[model samples]
Target: MNNNSSIDQSYTHLEIKIPLDPSANERLRSAVLSRLHELYGDPLPDAISDRVNAELDIFYNYFYSSLFLTYQKLVNCINGSGLPYYLFSSNGASLICYALGMTLVNPLPAHYRCASCRHTEFSNSADSSDCGLILPEKHCPLCGALMVSDGNDLPIEFFLGLRYDKTPYLALAVPHAMSDDAVSLLERSFSVTRKDPRDYKFPMEEGFIFAYLDIVPTDSDPESEMLWRSSSSAPSASSASLAPYEMTNARVFEYLSRPESFACYLPYRDDVQMIKSLLAADAVSVNNISDLSKICGLINSVNWFGFILPSLKSGAVDYRSTITCREDIFRTLVAHGLDSETSYRVMEMTRKGRAASILADNALRQQLLSHDISEDYLTSLVNIRYLPTRAHALELAMTVYRNASENVQG
Candidate 1:
């Protein structure tokens, strides 16, 4: 028994050294600064540097090193596999991740960036409210090349918290064909075990729990393919041949507004049917990315769809006015003169189904009412059992955008 115990201890204590590169921080800093210079031109703005530095500091200080190492390993394995994948959550909505090439979504405000001269411009008055794809075309002032419109106006707070307090979980969607292989590769690389086949847990120090990767196995083909092929009213064959990046935002929204086309974006068959019903009645409109995102959030939530559908049908509330996502609560309150911390608190409470508790405080309730927040809006918050984040909604919207673009370009 003593010999068996000795053997068990030896096995458990096997030295596994994944050395942390001493220069990693400096390298990351240099790479980020270089990319910013490339994107916004040399003599980088002070605001950009300060923001990036702060984010890096948070990462270096707050985030566990194993998380970064695991992410790098997974990315390297995925790239080697040659299967297409996309970051499917707030991680995708990060500027730092984009700069690091860990994600493709650029989280900058809606703007045009000139590839030739690196000239950038934000022409829209309501920059955060608009999608860059829908913006009017413009040529670079410094160069004749047409400027590229990108960015979802996603704040870094969506990825990190308001105080850079949130610990991130990496989520990625890989083609179903290679998901098993992806999981296996990740497990082998980490030398760690997964209780659930889809979630890979990384070894962390004591008290540093919740470090895991969520691998979502998804169909590789564009969701809109079947709809395009089946619909007689679909765009012309020539128009359908446009590349993903070539398709304009207006065209994408037009396609997404169709019940059949929009239904294709939904994951579950029941959700597809429910959304079809809503779209068929014209109770919902997909005018822009934000609208589409809200719809995504509505369907995924527990009571959000039921709560807003009647109002939408009766024309009492439009999609824009309703609190479809947690971000709406924050944005609305902040816009109506609430302080950032208070707005965030309200958002947090509302999302966690604690709005009743929030209202129970007379001072807080009075403060909300004093800001011209309607009783109806507060009531809607109380009904919310579950709410999606704006980051999540935007990620879904971007997925649909990319899939629509690919479907058309095919």
Candidate 2:
């Protein structure tokens, strides 16, 4: 256990234990292999074997033993305590997670149970009518549970790949308030990194997962924004003047470099990560156009972010209001020679989803039209950016409610 006092006292005792150097990855490797053998039965299928090895390789190579260990400990903690949680993040797409009982979502070749007969398992594709996910799926003649499409249809590559890294969001769904005894146990079991002492609230960009929990109190000092922690981890001496949650140019660029898995509003805190990641990188591409593939495909995870602009009146950015505004730094991106396709899609999401007339300057639109950008091509970009950040919140809440109910039953 880390003997250092937690930055936040709310998480004083909890510590996560993991090996120092897991280069060998043998212990985890053996554990996962044994679990897979038990789940899929003996000599695993080729497709399954390939997928397992691929994910494990990444996990091992990155030295993400703590991540897996965290999941294992978290699940054990919740299940042993009889709490209910539904895993729904991209990390939930891993078969290893499901086998470990950390998730109920499955990522594998889609399979369906026959509704009428109940016993028939089909390897073949099921049309929309036969799909259980869409409706009263083909009613299993023999049973109902078998006819449903695997509860998840997401690509595993979306969650983790050889080229990627992720910060796991194990949002706690505490159903209700904990008894003092339960609270003690919970505190002794895990730790939360503190946001900053100035505000005591988490950076809203990170979605304030514990905003409702009152695990930390709000810092009421008015000059708190100008304050700085003198720790080595603090941004920089020059940035010491910025508010705890406010962004500096360096901070913005650094965060943009590695897009977070959850959309955080931390230049604000507590806003959904999905919402934050959407727009920043798409616009950043305007300047770094030559690295378009790396910027768009690899570096930035989502294209749904806007620049964290300064507040005009007070000259202080309010983290909460900054995120809710639809205005992005698109115009600025256009000023830097942003091309049509990326700009048009990003701009479409703002100001009522229209591309040209509303968000884009007419001069930029004319430049695009001069290049013969088509209306069809402009509209072809799909809006599939719906991720369930709220569901994570609710899952933790449900767990709390369940725990409360169990206590009542007991």
Candidate 3:
């Protein structure tokens, strides 16, 4: 109805329409703003508020009318079960989604937040890396309390795109035991009339549910539901205790560094063996959660492992400073004085396997060089056929962490 070209015109022509509550947007806004204030203190930072409001506006104006009811239904079903789960991919990296309890990942830039004084300070300068975990130890200036360092430095654009027009999709991973029940609930809720019973179809696998709602036609007004996918896997006993939006756990990272722990998440035997070999040979070390996250990204990518493994094994490049995920490229460019937009463009291109073309552009090349971007870095980007997001990696790492912790306790 807004006449935005970015919205799929086909959606407008559909005969079905789900009646949305008039107060839904207002209620959502209130909840999100309350969560923001709770996380960042009263009178939220102008920058944070502006960014959140802008995203909210996009959702309200373009997406909420179509997806809100379905999302609400999905959330209700998932939360009703009391089972631990995580939203995967860029959707998981949204601050609004995190605040809405729709995701576990927090998309704020690397920062330190004090629990006592509610003081928050971003640490993403040229000198400091984008990873807060590696930042120098510091105490809150106001209360002298040690501040908690967290955040994955993911931009909202990663999920919503530059124009905020991308059709948002949700991919969730829930416990295997309740997957069938969740799917049945969704089917009943959406009045699902059709389904594709396929297993391990590319991204879909056993315990995966992909459903689209086609409401029964009626005499008055027809209704339809938004399409979404859910994946279920066997979770470790310890995973059930994970608190929502909890990111920092030193014990988890310690467990993740062990070679055998890689088996927890890596599905293939060979991939797990490769990672174990790397760890055994000291080819790569998992010093923190971020490091384990990089390993996740590398293993899932098309060419990154084969491309970078040699250098790592030969001690030519330290695994700690190497690029594994798209965030690494974005952080590197920003650290070299490139604006965030430009940095994101480069990162996006690289993820889409266009890094070679990026280096071929003379103007962009000279600009990058002027900012002291190394040719080696650009070359490294060329090898990135596909890159996983830090959000997904962290989610997987956290899952492994929870499982390992439970095993240790037992």
Candidate 4:
């Protein structure tokens, strides 16, 4: 950061107020200096100090204003609501963010130890996504309180470089709440814009950051009608001429671009965004998903999870049901990779109960959690059940089937 603030006659007025708080820059510096000293000893090596200072200056200058405050508010809201939020940006590579609690990923060296000698070593090796606590267990003779990883492999320079500020970071937040209640906290924050279905975008304001609020959908939401109406009203391009994912893509773009989140916008959860991600993915061909038109018709027209059951020969789904599953149609959904519990839920929805009960069954719900199914995915199913909007869910199902096919092919 240039210390010389020569007159900048061309500056815009700052509109948003940054809440009065301790300097994040100072906090980052203090933490970095202490960590460096621990690693390099009292008289820190000059080269390391220079590198650290340069990175911190860039970090402090850029974020200490708009980005920092915007994240602070959103993070605080997520924390207050007892929901999980994550930064999706490579800011994970910065020590300041890890120290500042902006990211859980540790950008530091991997910790290791020698089991025989009881000594400790910190170096990059087999690593986990969780950078801080992950360690390869070994011990050697050296007995220090800790070991530090050599960051040279992927240094701070890789993140800060000559121009880091040009990038805008994105974050995803998922919260658990009733169908009508999920967006209550987000509504409390400063909502800057509301999208319109006709594809409208307002100019971004100064003090605010853009947020794609995936608020829960409720029956009262007038915006919901827009999607159903638009999809039906648009001349469904002849199936032969329709681009893969085009309909789903247009619908999602319309949802986000429209000024809907102002008590009038956003989807029920991040699963919708996940659908967006799946459609945007480059590594996969959705050919199989296209082929399963019969299953898609069954799923979009009849049941959200049910159509895939018969094709899925797993014990969870009844084989007897496969006969009734309509194979003469050329293809059907084969539920794959899902555990017995999810398959069971599909079976239940197909045969006995409502999909909303999938989470209501505490035992099975816990099992799903135990299996580490994403909150976004599970919640999407629950909402789809309540929504009874098979067509919208079908868009997601197509993406899911496509992405799964790619993963298997890979």
Error of 4 at 243 (Å): 44
The residue-level lDDT of candidate 4 at 334 comes to 19
What's the true lDDT of residue 274 in model 2?
26
Q: After superposition, how far is residue 351 of candidate 1 from its true place, in Å?
A: 2.1
Q: Which stretches of candidate 1 lie over 4 Å from their true place?
A: 1-20, 63-66, 72-76, 79-86, 127-130, 173-179, 196-210, 217-251, 287-290
For each candidate, the alpha-carbon lDDT, in order, equals 0.63, 0.36, 0.60, 0.36
lDDT of 3 by residue, 96-187 (tens): 77787665556777778887888889875654344565566679999999887766667777776766755554444433343455556555
Candidate 3 deviant stretches above 4 angstroms: 1-21, 65-76, 79-86, 114-129, 133-147, 173-182, 191-251, 267-274, 334-343, 357-375
Root-mean-square deviation of every model:
8.8, 17.7, 10.2, 22.3
How would the candidate models be sorted by lDDT, starting from the highest? 1, 3, 2, 4
Q: Best candidate, TM-score-wise?
A: 1
Give the lowest summed-lDDT range of ten residues in model 3. Answer: 220-229
| Model 2 stretches astray by more than 4 angstroms | 1-24, 84-88, 112-122, 126-151, 179-183, 190-386, 389-410
Model 3: lDDT of residue 222: 13
Question: Candidate 1 residues 22-109, lDDT tens each?
Answer: 5566766676678888888887555556667667887777643444545556665665554444444566456667676555556666
After TM-score superposition, what is the CA distance of residue 34 in candidate 2 from its true location, in Å?
A: 2.5
TM-score for all predictions? 0.78, 0.43, 0.72, 0.35
Model 2, span 88-136: residue lDDT tens = 2444456666566565444555545433443433345544221123223
How do these models rank on TM-score, best leading?
A: 1, 3, 2, 4
Between candidates 3 and 4, name the one with more favorable TM-score: 3
